[model samples]
Target: MTKLIIQIPCYNEEATLGMTLAELPRQIPGIDQVEWLIVNDGSSDRTVEVALANGVDHVVSFARNQGLAHAFMAGLEACLKAGADIIVNTDADNQYCAADIPRLVEPILQGEADIVVGARPIRQIKHFSPIKKLLQGFGSWVVRLASKTNVVDAPSGFRAISREAALRLNVFNEYTYTLETIIQAGRQGMAIKSVPIRTNGYLRPSRLVKSIPSYVKRSLLTILRISMTYKPLRFFAVLGSIPFSMGFLLGVRWLVLFFLENGTRSRAPSLILAAILILIGFQLWMFGLVADLMAVNRKVLEDIQLRLRRAELNSNQKER
Candidate 1:
């Protein structure tokens, strides 16, 4: 009976959504049950009546605003159909620090981690802007090099996800699901950790980084479109090895200027521009070997959509 929901994702945040639900923590230890969801992404006001006068068990409504990565996957499908084993996505404007959310779900209740991420210390965050703390430490070092995963807060929306990493998250990115759900839970090999959380002083200013070169060009095109949708053959063989190593150093400098000018008219336009950049880097490494077989058929259709979302939410919780 682990439970623990705690989502947020609001919009039109009815004045900081009732001071961010008056410091949410219905209780937390090993968390028997600590709910509160929000989602209400289309809020015209009253953010779902201030998230049901601040008690907020669940809401998920969205008649329009549909953004923060589809209100964080519709608050992770309403906290996995209301049976949340653990899923804490904080931030309606109370920039974290709901008493550190039990140190961000204590490494997934000490099983070690399935997705923890709270790490917001970007050079002691005082309203950031040292170029937004060097673009959040170079966008968390390019999402720990496109999610090989040492997640030092890849745009942290204060995390914690396990219900088997929320049935293998998908978040196609409408702009932010906090950096495409930490590069889709660090390239899907889950066990992501981070911890060191705590913040809550900047009540406003980020509607998802309104502008810092348009939030580093939409967070580097959502980490290069989720690293070409989860490493399409090492992102097109490291993008076709930069023009296949500049067409193999320009066909070895046109074969050392044609064996020191013993023949060939002026290196035939430098060996036809090094054979058209080595056939455009071997046709971009054969489009990364057909996009790595369509990313292994999209990981076998995401393992049959995580076994049809756990057999359709355990057959609708055994039909109520």
Candidate 2:
């Protein structure tokens, strides 16, 4: 039997929880069972109460606020435990059209992709400022380049993950799961696709991005960190080459002067600076090589982890 679970990670979302739950489809084609799961990330309000009142199948609660990324991962694990073959994660704010859940999961049901993201019309969203839209586009472009995937909405939280894909994902970001997961999917060679999705008007201001500047700073750091984590050699190699290239040019300048104007005419300071920069660049390159080796070890470990999870899932099925 195939099971599909729709999960919402919420905090202080009592106002919109009911509406979000009400829109969820009770049944979808190709799914034997459909269930709702909500992760209460230490909401002080009646978020949990609202979930239970609305007949949510599962409620995972944290005593303290753990942020959206943690809540998302926890919800995924809970759904897996509940025998979900496919899981759809959406926002509690009802920002996305819950009706799109079916379309979001269609790719997974059709075996076309391991993960499917709901791509909203960023430019059309009235709630978003022009800068926000531009940043979203640029950020998605950067993610596409880094992950080598064609995901049009890298920051979209509305996505579906297959059981196998869920097991392999390991998120390190506490701020957000949007970008890191896409990069992870791409690096792991999981098929990822996106379908056009429409968004409801904003009910409230965003809690995730407090300010534009702060959001940009944290987001850039998250992207850079994940890029390095998954592609250390490529990331570091590009960085190392800049200084190396400059040092090479400086050395050439000194050499040309020495040959043409005699040794006395050569700038000793220039030669010394070039040598230091070259050494620093060489060290950075070596670090990249070492990190690449470590990344290989990480991959081997991940493969073992995947096998272990598969075995555990099989054991659980037999027990049931």
Candidate 3:
């Protein structure tokens, strides 16, 4: 039987927890059973109590607020341990329409995708400012480039993952998991797809995004970090090429000048600078080669980890 567990990573969401729970569907086509799980990220309020009251099937609690990325990973860990076949992640603020859960999981259910992300209509969303809309589009574009997948909404929290995909995903950032997970999945060659989904009106300002500038800064940094991790060779190649190309051009210019000046070493400043830039560029490329080797080791480690996780899960199931 295919079991689907919908998990929400919540903080101090006491006011809207019940409504969000109420809107969640108890049944969906192709899903044998539906379960609710809430990750209480050390909420100061009665978030855990509310989740229990709302009949959450599982509760993963933290000692203190560890950020959304931590909570998301924690939830995934819990769901995997709890014998979930499919996992759906949603927000506690009720931002995404819960009724569209089926649409979000359709690709996975049909065996067409391992990861399915919901694509919100950013342009049509009235609550989004024009600038927010533009940034949202731009950010998705950047993520698309990094992940090498056509994801329409990389920041979307509403997404579904198969058991295998869940086993493969790892979150390195404490900021958020949305962007990083997509890049990880795409780079790993997992079948990822997007489906158009609806959203509710604004309930509260985003806790993740304090402001546009902060969001952009964190996002750019996250993208850069992931790029280096996933594609170190390409990342460093492009970065080093800039200075390398410049140094080559400068060296050529200096050579032309030297020949024009009767091959005199009197004007050696340009040649010295060119040599320095070329050395620096070569060192950067060397770093990329080392990093690429490290990435290979990382993949081996991840494979070992996946096997251990499977063995542990099997042991837990046997005990049950």
In order of listing, the candidates' clash counts read: 0, 0, 0
Per-model CA lDDT versus the true structure: 0.85, 0.92, 0.94
lDDT by residue (tens digit), candidate 3, 118-222 = 999999998889999999999999999999999999999999999999988999999999999999999999999999999997889889989999999999999
When 1 and 3 are scored with lDDT, the better candidate is 3
lDDT of 3: 0.94
Q: Which pairs clash (backbone N, Cα, C closer than 3 Å) in model 1? A: none
The model with the greatest TM-score is 3
Off by over 4 Å in 3: 263-265
Candidate 2: give the clashing pairs.
none
Q: Give a tens-digit lDDT track for model 1, residues 1-320.
A: 78889998888988887987899889898898898998888878888987898789888888888788888887888799888989988888898888899888888898899888898888988878788898788889888888888888788888888898888888887888787777777777788888898788887898877889988998899889888888777778878788768878988987887788766557677677777877888888898789888889899999999999999999989998
Instruction: Rank candidates by TM-score, best first.
Output: 3, 2, 1
lDDT agreement of model 1 with the native? 0.85
Could you tell me how far off, in angstroms, the CA of residue 174 lies in candidate 1 after the best superposition? 25
Q: Write down the TM-score for model 2.
A: 0.97
RMSD (Cα, Å) for all candidates, in order, is 15.2, 1.1, 1.0
TM-score of each: 0.40, 0.97, 0.98
- Model 3 is weakest, by summed lDDT over 10 consecutive residues, at 263-272
Candidate 2's residue-wise lDDT over 158-233, tens digit each?
A: 9999999999998899999999899989988999999999898789898898998888888888889988888899
